[model samples]
Target: MRYLSLDNQRDGFILAARVLMMVLFVLFGWQKLAGFAGTVGYMASVGAPLPTLSAIIAVVVELGFGFLIAIGFFTRPVAIIFAVYTVATALIGHRYWALTGMDQYMAMINFYKNVSIAGGLLLLAVTGPGRYSVDGK
Candidate 1:
């Protein structure tokens, strides 16, 4: 019988989740920066009051939080920030129930998925980054 210590398991979880978050953040953030016009247009389509400003903010938040998560520096704060940001995205961008005159059902499902992921991120924030993190040192 072999057993992984509590600390080891927690660190493994943190590492996996952190890497996933890093990839997600970097990709989305880079999209916003690389395709500024497209991002602005998408924001406008989604009824963003200030599409340009929203794009900028999204880029910064995703990139900044992504870096923070990757390094495990202030992991809790970064995770919380990401959780809140994802929630807002789910609400505003994928307000599925609010969609009308088309296939609205699918939108709601996606929104819920985003919400679930946000919940996971919130959990990570509450749990901290465990023994493998910079804060654990």
Candidate 2:
């Protein structure tokens, strides 16, 4: 009975997790869209190759893939892509070794956070979007 209850709650929990995780990406993507030039500048500052294009990709990935995940469309593949993107951003944008002291500390923190998010995304890829999603588990 209890086990069945937990199983029944699975989809709801997955939905909640999907929404919560995607919120950050969507919000960040919106920020990038709102400040396109600034996002390009920041990408350049982070030494991202093809800064303008990279910024555009970031916005698209964060918003497009983020939305897809939130709505549970093509969830598995998108989660995998999002995980890779997250890790790539961690490596490219958060090169803590290049900085010193607090700056380095902060960058390292952000880098690990990105990595953590990526891990969660991979888990989502494995677990799938559940019955609440368009993918229908």
Candidate 3:
């Protein structure tokens, strides 16, 4: 069977995918900043060291780097960093093994979601942002 090709719209496809992938980070990061105290409290509850600092870093990575990814600036490096960050967050925040019942199920779902997002980021890193990006590659 023949498969449809997106070669003609590759750049547009990349831009759309990048924007979609980063939108969650941008929104969540903004939320974290808007509710700084609440975010810090949650981080502390999760046993994160220097919760305030962690929150700040998370905001930067999510908002700043996420924007960069969306705009296709430094696409490869940003994708790689975001991929690692996604996995790290999943492992740190979604410890399904440490929970039970519904909480465990929820955490497991989120963990896998994060992992899947990371996989997409990794693919973006390899393929790049395409010709319409700042990298123009």
lDDT of each: 0.81, 0.96, 0.92
| Runs of candidate 1 exceeding 4 Å displacement | 1-7, 100-102
| Candidate 3: tens digits of C-alpha lDDT, residues 27-114 | 9999999999999999898887799998998999999999999889999998998899899899889999999999999999999999
**Residue 86's C-alpha lDDT in candidate 3?**
92
For candidate 3, the C-alpha RMSD (Å) to the true structure equals 1.4
Instruction: List the candidates ranked by TM-score, beginning with the highest.
Output: 3, 2, 1
TM-score of 3: 0.94
| Backbone clashes in model 2 | 0
lDDT accuracy of residue 51 in candidate 3: 94
- Give me candidate 2's TM-score against the actual structure: 0.94
Instruction: For candidate 1, write residues 17-107 as lDDT tens digits.
Output: 8878678778889888899999999999988769999888889878877777777889888888888888888787887777775557777
Q: Give each model a TM-score.
A: 0.84, 0.94, 0.94
Q: If both were scored by TM-score, which would come out higher, candidate 1 or candidate 3? A: 3
Best by TM-score: 3
Instruction: Compare candidates 2 and 3 on TM-score and give the better one.
Output: 3
- Which stretches of model 2 miss by more than 4 angstroms? 1-5
Report residue 57 deviation for candidate 3 (angstroms).
1.0
